[model samples]
Target: MTIRFDGQVALVTGAGAGLGRAYALDLAARGAKVVVNDLGGDPHGQGENRAAAQKVVDEIKAAGGEGVPNFDSVSSYDGGFNMVKTAIDTYGRLDVVICNAGILRDVAFHNMSEEDWDKVFAVHLKGSFTVLRAAWPVFRQQSYGRVMLTTSSSGIWGQFGQANYGAAKTGMLGLMNVLKQEGVKYNTMVNTVAPVAGTRLTASVMPQEMVDKLKPEFVSPAVVYMVSNECSTSGYVIEAGAGNFSRASMVKGPGAQPGMAANLDAEWVQANWDRICSLEGAVPMWRAGQTLAAFQAANAKQA
Candidate 1:
């Protein structure tokens, strides 16, 4: 079956370039009305230009697809609200949202300043929240919506000199987890992508050979599929780039229990350390309830 968005409206933050641009363009090509939003800031999240957004809109029009340019910063509430307003005012409804706007501030944990941490969080984490919150009501009223939050390998597995960026990216996963539950009844699915695309953000850090292979376009397909009507599963994290796609999750091992007795101490935990950390029988948790249930089951076995 062909996945198309004939009457759908989509908003792609940071659409001026990279993954966001690819997503916006592809959505338009598939018959969706797209809102191309970009503050045109540098990699560190400074400065802005209206032309960046206008260019993408022009490209969409040239390809016989409908699109509008929005020059709103996703870092603030007002900016996020206005971007969604632009979509509703132009297309009359919104069906999808791609929270791809972000900034990078790389620094060692010891040297990272308060400003560095705050700025990264503002763009990646708070920005996603701002836009999603603004669109929550519309999604609820329409009884349908698809949201894609951008995560990163640095956030999931960790990376040196990227403490701030990693923390914000991981926080997005937490937000997605909650939204998935809240939106399930409304047919609003929330998912995440930990993309390894060769964009301005990664140009300096990644090796040239790897960068050549991991184009921004390679990452957009996963984004497109995740937000399409064909996909219904939520609370999923997909890693995509260079024609490679895979799912990632947090899993738990079969941990050792200290029992329900009062005399249990740190020594007991130390003695059973290997069992606590063993990967055997590890499983990905579907929800918070599973963790508690697993603990209880383990205790029952001990009893």
Candidate 2:
């Protein structure tokens, strides 16, 4: 079946360049009315202008797609509200938001400044939350919405010179998880994507061999599905790159227990550390409820 977003509106932050630009264009081409937003900042989050995102909007309109350009930064409450305001003012309603805005302020752990830490979080972590805080009520009223969070492998796996960026990305893993639980009440969906391509944020670190393999277009299809009403998932993180896609996930190990008559003790925990930390026979689960049920079942066996 064709995945079409006809009559839908999407706001994509950081849409001026890189992965954000690619996602904005893809949505517009597939019948979405897009809001292309960018602050026109440097890689370090230091500036603002309009040409970058505006150009993308012009391109979409030229191709017969509907779109508008917004130069608001996603790093503040006012800006987040305004971004949503633009979609409502122009397109009448919003169906999706791709929180893809981010910046790099690389420094050693000891040298990281308050400015560096705050700006990085402002764009990547708090930025995503601010937009959602502004949009959640509207989504609730409409009874439908989609949120796509931009996370990174660097954060998931850890990297040097990225303490600030990594912390923000990892925060999204938890942010989206909680959002998923909340979204279930209103039929909203939220998911994270760790993309790998030769985008501006990735160019220096990506080698030619890897670049040749990870096209943004290849990853777009998966994104389209996740943001569409067709997807039956939330609180999930999917890693896409180099023609390989996998779900990077968290797991609760099958832990050990002393007899039901005995209280849990440090000595018991030490003895069962292997099972508590074991990844062998690990199963992929999506929510806390599932883990709770599994734990209860394991406890019942002892009882």
Top TM-score: which candidate number? 1
Candidate 1 error regions (>4 Å)? 207-210, 297-303
**What does candidate 2's lDDT look like per residue over 47-105, in tens digits?**
78899999999989998999999998899889999999999999899999999998888
lDDT of 1 at 60: 96
lDDT of 2: 0.87
RMSD of candidates 1 onward, in order: 1.7, 2.1
Cand. 2 TM to true fold: 0.92
TM-score, per-candidate, Cα-based: 0.95, 0.92
List clash counts for every candidate, in order: 0, 0
RMSD of 1: 1.7
For model 1, the run of ten residues with the poorest summed lDDT: 254-263
